[model samples]
Target: MAPEPTSPVAGEQQDRSGETQDPATYEITKPLDEESPLLSPTRDEEQEGLIEDGSVHHDRDETSETKPLWYMILLTISIGGLQLAWAVELSNGSPYLLSLGLSKSLMALVWIAGPLTGTIVQPYVGILSDNCRSSWGKRTPFMIAGSAATIISLLALAWVREIVGGFLGLCGVDRESEGVKVTIIVVAVLFVYVLDVAINTVQAGIRAFILDCCPSHQQEAANSMASRVLGVGNIIGYVAGNIDLPKHLWFFGNTQFKVLCVIASLALGSTVALSIGTVRERDASLEGPPPKGRGGLIAFFKQVFKSIRRLPPQTRKVCEVQFFAWVGFFPQLFYSSSYIGDIYVQPFLEANPNMTPEEIDKLYEKATRVGTFALLIYAITSLATNVFLPFLIAPSYDSPANASLRAQRGQHTRLSRFLDHLVIPWLTLRRAWLIAHLIFATCMFSTLFVRSVGGATALIGIVGVSWALTLWAPFAIISAEISKLEEVRRLRASSPDDNNNNNTTDQAGIVLGIHNMSVSSPQIFATVGSSIIFKFLQKPRGTPGDHSIAVVLAAGGLSTLVAAFLTSRIQDEVEIPEGVVVEEGLAAFGVLSS
Candidate 1:
């Protein structure tokens, strides 16, 4: 017979009934000391896999402190690769589609594939990875498979026209035929869908891997490293988007989009391979097979619904804020480049009224590159914000008691002391998030008055501050709440008189998945809404002054205003004992860490 599963701590063992013995029941060989680390409430909480730094520790073979700094860096670099691909897509996808003769309205519909796939693929992959029992480990196999798919789909998307043309030629179809054009567009759309699905799978697996590998104490550091790497990737991606790649690197591809795809594929494949090769994952098969029947699609959705219903008040409020925030973010994320490009092209269109179609197309491409430069500015500002914002805002775990302890210990450097003096004590994470929402709303609305490329660039660059906070704050809030929920579940489990037996489900994966749903579901609404606006409000094709994209941006601003109000309503403060002090570590957003 198989041996009973053992708990991480030495004196804790699973009973025959599969329940952990109460801590009170465990025999003590030595007299307990009041100041003993084992007896401390903070230590108890850490043992329960909940860290105050907002890093969720699930199951892992080693502590992050035991791992070398280089190892942590390598492990987290894959997320940067993921962000690079995403940045490239967000910066150039719409322009590439327009180049292929797709209408602006239809282009919005095509973009819906991202949120649609994210809604289904991310959660399903999260659940699936959780239950995986492969020799290569639960997360490794999925990351490898997802990375391969992403590389393949990205290449296919980049070369879609060539692929479709080759197939049409083989079938003796005329290249100039309307049918041929429609077929090429259809293939490109399908490839975009596949690419989005593959990327989502990789993203979900990478995040789970980080949580599973990092120990309780170092969760914050690991996450911070990942975030910084992601920021680097964003910077590189936007910079590349701004450059004239065809002029500088003709060997990579004929067009800028194709070259970016090749670069992203190489970056993703190499980073994933490096991490997979260097990291020795624990064999999950040793954990025993996943619970039977829970792997099915119907069961998955049922669990999701159950999780949604059981979300904690704090988590539910965070989700509400995220929903509206994403509604505000979607238009800027997908359309800012196009919006700025349209503005840049307006004057040129008037100056060259009798320009040829090819000349007009060239002008649009040039204007899009300028817009891409603006996004580059946005990326740079966001990276700077991610680096400096942590010191300016108080951590979620910080309290006056902990502050006094840090001060007594002489741990504050001169810079930190100055920052502390400068920081308003009332500027908590929730309030900063609220401020970010307000900034985003104001910037989005500012587009209504922007007529020059410079003004648009300035507005977008300012939005970076909000973007950085958006990337960090919600996840931090939700993570703390989830950790609290996990503690409650553990407390109930250890209670002898507690009769509830259905608390076996892992709260981290389920709640995080639900949070992801909140972020993604709004994108679907935003895309559909933008499409309708484009259909009705956009000027005719080849018109000189189309402000439909601006209109969508303003709508997003309105949604962000709602998010700001909801953010103000979220309760973030909780009382902590005077002696307990959890160290402040780096915090970052979920997917794009830095």
Candidate 2:
């Protein structure tokens, strides 16, 4: 073990070559406060210090098996802030678009950018981050750039008409013409595309960053924490979304869209600042290490193919799970607001048969608020599960060598006997996901029957269990497989006689990028599919949204069950189950034949 630095001052240890010591001696050092910048690294400084790629840092070799509690806090806060900002637009943007006097077709057209950006931007960003050897660190620069672009696009989204008006005037176009309005909408769509790309960039960077920084064993825990923070962020964002932002905020702007965005900007910006202070970034080049690989844009496409050919079948299942899971989830997520809004839309229209257009707008806003509240319920339930699930999953053994933990009352008792075929963790990914899919499927199926806000809230809230699983489980399984692959590499490297001209390269960023494609693909499919379905099912414009939304949601429910089935086929990377809660889980057969 290396000795601790002897200096109380800002002195770093030097080797024979007069270079600062390696990561083996100190993981990272951060400046603590603004007055003493050396004592406290800013988020930028933290990123500037990230270790380069190639060598894996074994958590077992460290003094602690995991990052400090404060590091976790910083991670959750920063990432959570990102989720919240991102969620605000997601949860409320549809209603905002409707309010902008857009038809269903126009809104769908605008949404094309969402899936396109997810599909294109995320993977490419991952490749760039993987090969990047910048002094500012691989991931942070991208994240910072994304954040700036996203914020700018969001502001432009809020005020596109005004901004485009100036441009139109410069081009000698009449501001009052319909053509000018069409141009504004086009400009707005462009901004939305940019916004989607920007958000994707940051998301890809952060997801890879987590994997890069954390060791193998902690991947599940880190992912779960991220999921929890995501819930918290969504909750914060949803709450903000629910607020009845007045058409005019004298100090901020004249439109609710503009005002709410300014609010989101402040909230997102502050959390990012906090994250910057606490988390450390890596720069592997500091050691004057062997020159790194550079593939540029072409490298990304090559990495995609390499990942496809090289990844194990077990690792590949993460994509399958994600693809099907999100296929089920996207319809539910994208249409929830409209679905719930439609319920009120019909009732309001009937009661005030002669209601003015302005009054109709008011009623629609109320529907949106109701939908936003349901979204809030979903977020809270997700948070509750995220916070408590670790304990629920912790094995309770009758003895050290017991095969199964004692089944808690709900997990193993009478309920277990009934739904054990489709319920909670008896072990690794297979059983755990089976339960998640069943529960979520049940919730999705129930959406068809929901007639009121209260029922919808309860149903959606319960689905958070599966939502939590979706966030963490696949990553956990994939990371475990990756750890195994890394061990294989280490073994080959150590074997004197196992000489092979080529060895496997563990490019975590590339792997994660491919996995992200699995997620984004479903969103695209669901978006297009939903657009088609809603056109046929929806009531004509000027009458609420769509009331028979349950039909749309039922598809999602069925898809989740399919995902559950797919999960059953996946091979377990870790132990199946440490302990059996129900004695029935162990079937005893008669004699040798049994």
Give the per-residue lDDT digits (tens) of candidate 1, residues 138-223. Answer: 78888999999998998898888889988898999988889888988899999999999999889888876765564433344455
- lDDT per residue, candidate 2, 343-456, as tens digits? 757777777678887888888778877887888888888888767665445321112222122232122455434333332345554566678889989988887777787787
Off by over 4 Å in 1: 1-44, 47-72, 216-224, 278-282, 399-423, 483-501, 505-507, 573-594
- What 10-residue stretch in candidate 2 is worst by lDDT? 585-594
TM-score, per-candidate, Cα-based: 0.84, 0.77
RMSD of 2: 11.8
Q: Largest lDDT belongs to which candidate?
A: 1
Q: How many pairs of residues collide in model 2?
A: 20
**For model 1, what is the error of residue 19's alpha carbon versus the real structure, in angstroms, after optimal superposition?**
21
